[model samples]
Target chain A: MATAVNFKSEESQAELIQLVSFNLDREEYGVYVLKVREIIRMSNVTRVPNTPYYVEGVINLRGKVIPIISLRKKFSLSEKENDKQTRIIVMDVDGELMGFIVDSVSEVIRVSAGEIQPPPSVVNGGVDQEYLSGVINRADRLLVLLDLERVFSQSERESLINSSL
Target chain B: MAILCEDEELLEGFLAETSELLEKLDDDLVALEKAPEEIELLNGIFRSIHTVKGASSFLGFDLLVKITHKTEDVLNRLRKDELKVTPEIMDVVLEAVDHIKLLVNDIRNGEIVERELDEIINKLIPYISDAFRESAVLHMESAGTSEREKEVPASPVQTELETEAAAPAQERPRIEAAPAPSPQPPKPNSSKTVARGEELSDNTTVRIDVKRLDDLMNQVGEIVLERNRILQMNQDYLARENTANFGEEFSKLAKRIDFVTSELQMQVLKIRMIPVEKVFKKFPRIVRNLSRDLGKEVDLEINGEETELDRSVVDEIGDPLIHLIRNALDHGVEDPEERVAAGKPRTGKVVLSATHEGNNIIISIKDDGKGIDPEKLARKALDKGLVTEDQIAGMSGKEILDLIFLPGFSTKEKATDVSGRGVGMDVVKTNIRKLNGIIEIRSEVGKGSEFILKLPLTLAIIQSLLVDVENEVYSIPLAAVLETLKVDTSSFHVVGGQEVLKLRDSVLPLLRLQKLFGVQGSETSLNQSYVVIIGVAEKRMGLIVSRLLGQQEVAIKSLGKYLADAPGIAGSTILGDGRVALIVDPAGIIEMEESGVTGAWAA
Candidate 1:
């Protein structure tokens, strides 16, 4: 029990990383705690004209207007209806705030850096390896760590092309 | 010597005060050149330099002190009538002032680079009177000796403190030497002199950081949004409630809040308003220098310098305005001999004026010289293959003149460094369009050409006409909206595969927003739809939408870098019920229209 509590507090350790995990199409994804600003329930996003299909448009985050991206559309997964479980994970990437729509937010999970295995050459569910930082195996599920800088910076349309190929 | 002032606040204050003085000096020096014997102007110039010298000396910036001191002595001699103001003398003085500006910027940036101060200092010394030069040397030596002897080398701050105390005492002898009835030297603590006849107007204004004003504007935007929400809620409340007294009191309070919010927004916007003269200030000097360089006798007449615009607009207009004025001087103006042979005055006139027209500011640069010849422009465009002969044949005179603004178009046989290599006018047009400004050219061959720029007052907030297209709302800036009409679809005609609607005498080209944006929805009504006519420069287009959602005052917010350059969307603004609505870029849509990319209009 003492060891378990220490593992949770080990986030302050140099090699341990804390991530805010969320669900997208039954797949668990984790982004660094530092990058995740806040999670908001799905709200009305104004549709932008003449943008990529995956660009969900923009939403008013407080007084600021920030762009929203649909992770499902980005991964080429079938579109699902946004219900109570739909949440927008707002992340600060390169000083810009962008919100990503996911199925639901799970919890803040702490993991040892060694526990994260490098992503394999191929991954399931149409997600590109370029966007995956690593994969961690839990007792009953797998948590895929996402490199948001790559996921948001690299154009989704280009990634879609790579995935299709 | 390296500057080592520990107090960041004092250094910042000195930088602010001195930079403001330097800007005014640029205008004053130009005016002094035109009227060399204006004593009040001469005194103001002298006082500005003295204040700079005093402040820098306090901050222990030895290099700035040396430059401003020598320049101050020259200005003192000019004011005392010991030295005459000639082009040669003004050139050296302006050079010194420019160097001072550079040094001040260096200190502000926190890294002092080495400058060749000896060259400019040597040039300024020749303009100083012999007696003042001798006394100035004596004063410098004494001040230098006292500083070395009294202050320890370890404590630079103490030395700066002593100098700050001694700065005014040092100025007294210099002012006393100028004899009676000259402008009194400013007090020790106050480093700035009252500029000319203007009364000492301190404490009436505060020097605010622009970022703070931007924050306040954002807060006001939020307030405006909240006010809108309240108004909507009150309407719903009044409609749903049967309690008359409760509803009346709630509405009275809402009305009061609404009025207060509008006033607050206006006041905040007013704080960001600066006179266009901030940009117009540099022109006289530029004209003087460029006209002399070009050997063309030109007179620049400036009017409506007091017309105010947003500070953001003021900042961006400086470069474009300079290019336009230079174009007028270089290409539009004729040489003295040419003008005389053409039966015109030897001196060409370039009138630069600014005035408020409704919600827009109209700035025109009108030159009385060799006006643009449209036939020549057309021929050139054809040769360059920018436009074909058939296109030119169909264009009017004004449209042909606008061909100059097309990219890669230049009328000059050879590019000159003055007006830049051919890329100026298009870039100018693009920049103006970015501000939602319209640039129009009106010219008569051999008479003159006038380039009129109509710019919105502020980029932050605008009165936009909101329209709904397939359940998605968009805003069109009312400044660009000519009028909205409910037109019958059956009356529309397809001419040459392009949709057109004949409204009165003009055949207005129509573009459906739903089709343009690829909006997937059925038409609201097949019988009739709303057409919003928008005019950008000379080209007019009608935008068809499902419903007209009246007008709104919207605060524009950027869609971040990822979605920054979406083709037809300028930006997004949050609406009354916290929904984001995109602001349509009419200019961008027009570009799409010319490219034939947006699909044909649908009934």
Candidate 2:
């Protein structure tokens, strides 16, 4: 929401933007906590019959059937066996509850406005420019705050409705 | 609630009730033309219009009330046997009904129709038997219950109306519903009729928010799934473990839960079931005006108006059905003189009936008129470049009839404003297919055409036949599945680089699921494997799958924005084991094949 963006762009250190951070390959990425509904251990994901390679499948989160997207495959990152550290961070993408398979979820941290800066197109870890929102320059490492909306745009959601038709 | 809010609420209630009553009134008034002395039908018509007037006056729709009052005057005179139900009088009443519908619709949409009601009121005046006839009957009708008017003086206006028409007469405490600036409304006028009176109980049914009922259905779905999961877990443990007594008790408990959960689910689904009468009611008037416009005569016989369907289906099926009826009146049914010269009944019969066929609802519109001439349709198809002569040579009679559904292929040489614009049947086909329904056409050149539509019982949940193509499970909605086959390898032959399976004498196009979805699977499964024969209308395809997972009732859920437009995938469903499976849209698969990369199925 704009509130989270406002917190990032504001001057007050007291106003902090909360983000849930996770790993794709090596580098860390963060999405606003508001977009992250929940994070759970990866469970049984029945493969959808016909979909893009990156679309791992879908998982039943409680009773709702949610399609899952694999970040590793989507961003052309190296793949590895899913270990105990793997977590499916369920995010509300345009009101649909979709799960994102991340390496693991780290601690939820709050960063002030001045800490965030526009992302550079060529990141050292080689992440796609479209999915990056801004770089949160944390003291330990550069945290890339992802733009969930741009990653899954309105056009995609419209296709979901059209596909179901 | 605020005063204005309460007024709007009451206004909403009144509009819903009146519009429904008006819809039924349209059919009753037309029926009265044939059997003019059917007093009960006349009473039904008069009471409907009277109720609308009374409610409109109370709700302060002065214009609407006045128009309906004029309409009621004519209808009331007809009821008193002082007026004849002539075609001209029927036109005026039907016109008034249309106008009231307009005003009511506008009012329902929160717009006060500013157009003067003088034209309709004036049109109704000539039809009124005695323009100066004392409204003594309506006034005297109110005298039937002066006792109730005395009992409930809180809303003297409504109390006065309770006697004016078909009010229940026995008012018990008034219910005091719908927020009160008007203290309470009079029982909301019983918007729905009691379906049967054979087994009479208290017979009280409460109005519930449709959203609440939908929510209840979803929750019931959740409970059913949860129960299935528990039963599966217990049965597996019992089979594997050495706990004998625990197994006995657990099996018994699972059986009980299964029975209760299924009952709960069925009851919840039934709550959303509404008779298709609401959709059928407006047709008589529609046919009336249509026949009048074209100078034709049509006798619309409606059967099985009481066939119940899920409310969601009822809401959507109305438009498509209307267009089909229009088609029948325009193209299918012959003009009155033409019918007589053809040695047929003077009044063409258009039978609109709904019947429950197993899990699906089959609504057929059968017309006794000139059936479609395939040669003409084939020539039209050729002229429109919709099909080649070579394609026509290979087509069957049904395929030629099916050409009407092809876009831009209307057979009418002279385009009429009624139904021959060439866009309706295609739209009808598309809309019906959108509801996961099928539209079938059957006709003989001399005999009439019947447009049979098979629609699902509900939209949210569907019984799906789940299949596996290489370990990946896909669901084919049971509605679209024609049948299943374990076709031998010899039945499938390569024809011009495309696989065609000979199902007896007919050649069915073969769609390999793994190739369609681009799923990586063993091609060997195609040999002597399970094939789901799915069809929409005349286009049938055999979908090859690895395993048949049996049938399961799945609640359809949309894939969130990311994977929304996956071709051949309709929506996803959560299986009993809490794993997600994509619901195969058979219609979508056919559309994709036709529109995109055709013959790309060659692996």
Best by DockQ: 2
Query: Per-residue lDDT of B424-489 in model 1, one digit per residue for the tens?
Result: 897787778778788889988898999999999999999999999988899999988989999789
* Backbone clash pairs in model 2 (N, Cα, C under 3 Å; residues 3+ apart or in different chains), count: 1
Specify the highest-lDDT model's number.
1
Model 2 residue B119 CA deviation (Å) reads 3.6
Off by over 4 Å in 1: A1-15, A154-165, B1-3, B129-244, B502-508, B523-527, B599-603
Could you tell me which 10 consecutive residues in candidate 1 chain A have the lowest summed lDDT? Answer: A1-10
User: In candidate 2, residue B146 scores what lDDT?
Assistant: 50
Off by more than 4 A, model 2: A1-5, A8-14, A120-130, A156-165, B1-16, B77-83, B110-115, B125-244, B525-527, B561-564, B596-598, B601-603
Alpha-carbon DockQ of candidate 1: 0.48
Candidate 2 structure quality by residue, lDDT tens digits, A1-165: 343355654457567678888887888889989988999998998676446566788777787778888888877888878999999998887777888899988989888767778777676655677678788886689888887766666665555335432
TM-score of 1: 0.84
Worst 10 residues of 1 chain B by lDDT: B195-204
- Candidate lDDT scores, in order, read 0.78, 0.74
